[model samples]
Target: MELPEVVSRSEWLVARKKFLAEEKEFTRRRDELNANRRRLPMVLVEQDYVFTGPDGPVRLLDVFEGRLQLVVYHFMFAPEWDAGCPNCTWLSDDIGRLDGLHEMQTTYAAVSRAPYEKIAAYKEQRGWTFPWYSSAGTSFNYDFHVTLDESVLPLEYNYRTKAEWEALPSGGLVQGEQPFDLHGMSCFLRTGDAVHHTYSTYGRGTDSLGFSGTVIDLTALGRQEPWELPAGRIPAPDHHADGCH
Candidate 1:
């Protein structure tokens, strides 16, 4: 791998300080964006979606656990599949403990199309403490646009249709395939007896949830993804070639 040019400590500090200013500006911009996100209009969720849990049937409101806010990770675990998606499992591993989020009046859980038995067994095997539920009998996944029907040719993902996913040189399965399930996160807000869909993000938008990626971004390699590298920066030989989009 190509290394950065050798520089004196004083020269390094000058470059670091300039980059630090840019980082601060980025942080400020992110804060503004977050505020705007919070201000986005919310739509009331009319569907009475029910999910199966380890205990018994759970209503959409119950999934909030009486919290003011709910964050559901749409895990890709089909009913017939023996296990959950490896990518979803990787994200689950980065979720860490949720007591802090709970303390702030937010509850986090994972929802999948798999049956309760399948979800329970997989959850136990992964040693995850966060709640997971099965939306097998409900249209929860479909309503959220995280699950596509087999007939839907060009699957919509990340808010766009990718008609050539399977035909691409990278050769990846499309979401339109059988056992259709996709990864995403949806946020809901509870007001009185009503729940409102606040926001949802799919694909690369959920990358911020992985703390490891944030740490990696601090290094010279910067995610080791071609798109993330600065212009003219020589990427590592083993950098990922496939783009997340």
Candidate 2:
């Protein structure tokens, strides 16, 4: 019924110093990993993907919206689905209020496997204004490894698992393809109009809840009890986005 607190000033200092020294290794490794991720090889996206926007059909490159760099979050909002994926919902909640990302010369948008009508309905329900697109008509999902017939994620390589090893299900029982949704943000840079697919992935699906920025949710403020906004209080447009319509 109570949390024990008996550490003295000296004890606290020693413990804090120990924690800092131990955690420094982890911090250093993470920073190095991030640096390596930024340096990852850039490959030309040969596939010309098309997605439905608020108005009409648009090319994926158009999502850049003339910015030198583009960051796309493959949100989960497929037509057959009842709602967006929970993990994606977490990211979208953050994506909605980032107006300053544009100041960095980077444009961020979200795309879902769901069709335009479904996405629009969802957006209206959630009150989200970020440009949400539908990639139901193209191989964009597959190309990004987020739309597969089986949930076992693809595109893997390791000295232990061969050059092209397939990912297994979250649990042991593998069923349907859960094609990779490219969770988090994938960054791309355009050099002289010849766009280059640069850095990608903020989540990368590696750690479910490790990214500091991605974690630390404040529940006392946001109405998440029923996973919906307060009634009669201008609910988010996409929160009500349902595929049935």
Give residue 41's lDDT in candidate 2 (0 to 100).
85
Q: What is the lDDT of residue 232 in candidate 1?
A: 71
Instruction: Give each model's whole-structure lDDT.
Output: 0.81, 0.61
TM-score of each: 0.84, 0.69
Candidate number with greatest TM-score: 1
Candidate 2 lowest-lDDT run of ten: 156-165
Runs off by more than 4 Å, candidate 1? 150-155, 162-176, 225-245
The clash count for each model shown is 0, 31
Q: In model 1, which residue pairs have backbone atoms overlapping below 3 Å?
A: none
RMSD from true fold, candidate 1: 4.2
Backbone clashes counted, model 2: 31
Off by over 4 Å in 2: 1-6, 150-174, 177-184, 202-245
Across residues 1-245, which tens digit of lDDT does each residue of candidate 1 receive? Answer: 55578899999999989989999999999999999999999999999988999889999999999999999999888888899987788778888889999999999999999999999999999899999999998878877878876563445555555555444554554523454777889999999879999999887667777787778767876665545667475855323221212
Best by lDDT: 1
